[model samples]
Target: MPYVLLAAAIAAEVGGTTAMKYSEGFSRLWPSIATVIGYVLAFALLAQVLKSMSVGTAYAIWAGVGTASIAVIGMLFMGEAAGVARISGIALVIIGVVLLNLGGSH
Candidate 1:
């Protein structure tokens, strides 16, 4: 289903971003290759999702979710700060994505 593809795309995007943190400005070999591969697969799956989903809706979800996911990943696993402001920001992003989907249905 398109939703499944969207989820995969989001996961790939998140993975790519996480790998980017370890890429050391692309100087590292394996992480750099992983980043490129992750993004390639993400875009490919996202393209498939677009076949049935509206661009505004799909892209909003993809970007919003990916951003929020990366933020959380940073806090939880990457030793980034998990301050209140950052948590609030992620909540806002999720709400915005939900609102976008709701509006797009009309």
Candidate 2:
């Protein structure tokens, strides 16, 4: 299903972003390579989902989900700050994604 593909794309994007944090300003070879691979896969899957989805809706969902997921990953696993402002921003991204889905036609 397209939704499944979309989810995969989001996961890939999130993974790529997380890898970026560990890439040490691109000095690390492996993580940097992984980041490139992840992003390539993400864009490929996202393109597939876009075939039948609206550009606005698909991009919004992809970016929102990817951002929220990476934020959680950072808070839970990475030593990133779990401050109220960051959490609130992530919540807003999730809520905005949900609202976009609700407002769109199937």
Candidate 3:
């Protein structure tokens, strides 16, 4: 299903981003390889998702969800500061994605 593909795409994207932090400017081998592979999978899956969904809707969801997930990963695993402003920003991203989907469905 397209939804499944989209979810996969999101996961790959998140994985890719997370790996990027570990990549250390390409000095590491595995993480850099993972980054390339993850991004490839994400884009490939996203292309498939486009077959059924509008570009605007799909892209908004992809970018919004991917960004939000990365931010959470940073806060939880990467020891990034989790201030109220950053949390609120992530919440706004979710809200914006929801609103975009709602409007796009029509």
Candidate 4:
């Protein structure tokens, strides 16, 4: 399904972003490679999903989910800050995404 692929793309994008943090300005070979590969796969899958989905809806969902997931991953694994405000913002983004999907379906 397109939605499943969109989720996969978001996950891949988050993985890529996390890897980028570990890349140390592109000096680390493995993490850099992972970042490149992950982003490429993410975009590819996103393009595939676009074939069946509205561009605006698909892009908004992709960006929202990817941003929220990446923020959580960064906080958990990259020692990034997880301030209350940031968490609350991410929660709002999730809520918006859910509402968007529900509204679009019916």
Best by TM-score: 3
Tens digit per residue, CA lDDT, model 1, 1-106: 8889999999999999889989999999999999999999999999999989998889889999999999999899989999999999999999999898778622
- Model 1 spans with C-alpha error above 4 angstroms: 104-106
How close is every model to the real structure, measured as TM-score?
Answer: 0.93, 0.92, 0.95, 0.93
TM-score computed on alpha carbons, candidate 4: 0.93
Model 4 alpha-carbon miss at residue 33, Å: 0.9
Model 3, 1-106: lDDT tens digits are: 7778988999999999999999999889999999999999999999999999888888888999999999999999989999999999999999999898778632
Number of colliding residue pairs in each model: 0, 0, 0, 0
Q: Which has the higher lDDT value, candidate number 3 or candidate number 4?
A: 3
Steric clash count of candidate 1: 0
Model 2 lDDT tens row, 57-98 = 999999989988988998999888999999999999999998
Give every collision pair in model 1.
none
Deviation in angstroms for 55 in model 4? 1.0
Which residue segments of model 4 deviate by more than 4 Å? none
Of 1 and 4, the candidate ahead on lDDT is 1
Q: What ranking of all candidate models by TM-score puts the best one first?
A: 3, 1, 4, 2
The models' CA-based lDDT, in order, is 0.92, 0.91, 0.93, 0.91
TM-score of 3: 0.95
